[model samples]
Target: MKGVVISMIVVLAMIQFMVKPGQAISCGQVDASLAPCVPYLTGGGNPAPACCDGVKNIKGMAATTADRRAACNCVKDAANRYSNLKDDAAQALPAKCGVQMNIPISKSTNCDVIN
Candidate 1:
């Protein structure tokens, strides 16, 4: 019984790290040429026009190349810059929702792609 209880607790703890918020924050208001794009994955209000534009633009950039690695890199870069992703959410975002955020890495690269 003791071992079973301990195992359950460990599993639940691991599960917590797997959870992520619905959305991310955006980078519209900021300078575009520098950072270019930001994510509004935090899910509070509708992302600003610029935010949406940036994402579209990044997506376009990624599509242009067959590698598409840039798209994932862009998303990861954006998440690190715009969103306050920390701890589990940050980790999970890169791992589970990397595509959603446009990043391909399964771990936080701590990239400063944005200026």
Candidate 2:
């Protein structure tokens, strides 16, 4: 019985290494996808086809809650990187792209508020 328990413990430890738990998707994916939307998000122009495509891509990538939160944080950071971002314009990208985001994408948005 003791040998069996030891073997089980070893197997569990190996499994832990193989499958890292709580590994949220990289925020870089979100950043890359949304890069094209910067001009529109900053109120410089209407969202282009590429910008809308990025929004769709990001929306599809952020499937899990953790991924969504990470995406929200990344997008918020990206938004802050801009100089003259209009809040309404930033908020309207999702609608323009026909992709609804679980987490709001804005410089002033609180990532913690997203699920």
Locate the minimum summed-lDDT window of 10 residues in model 2: 12-21
* Tens digit of per-residue lDDT, candidate 2, span 8-94: 545643543453446664555666566667678766568999788878877776778778888888888878888788888888778
Q: After superposition, how far is residue 95 of candidate 1 from its true place, in Å?
A: 19
* Tens digit per residue, CA lDDT, model 1, 2-115: 788557545644543453533222222112311312232443333445445543443443433332444445445545655453434433432232234343332365334421
**How much is the lDDT of residue 88 in candidate 1?**
47
The candidate that achieves the highest TM-score relative to the unseen native structure: 2
lDDT of candidates 1 onward, in order: 0.38, 0.73
Per-candidate clash tally: 10, 0
TM-score of each: 0.35, 0.73
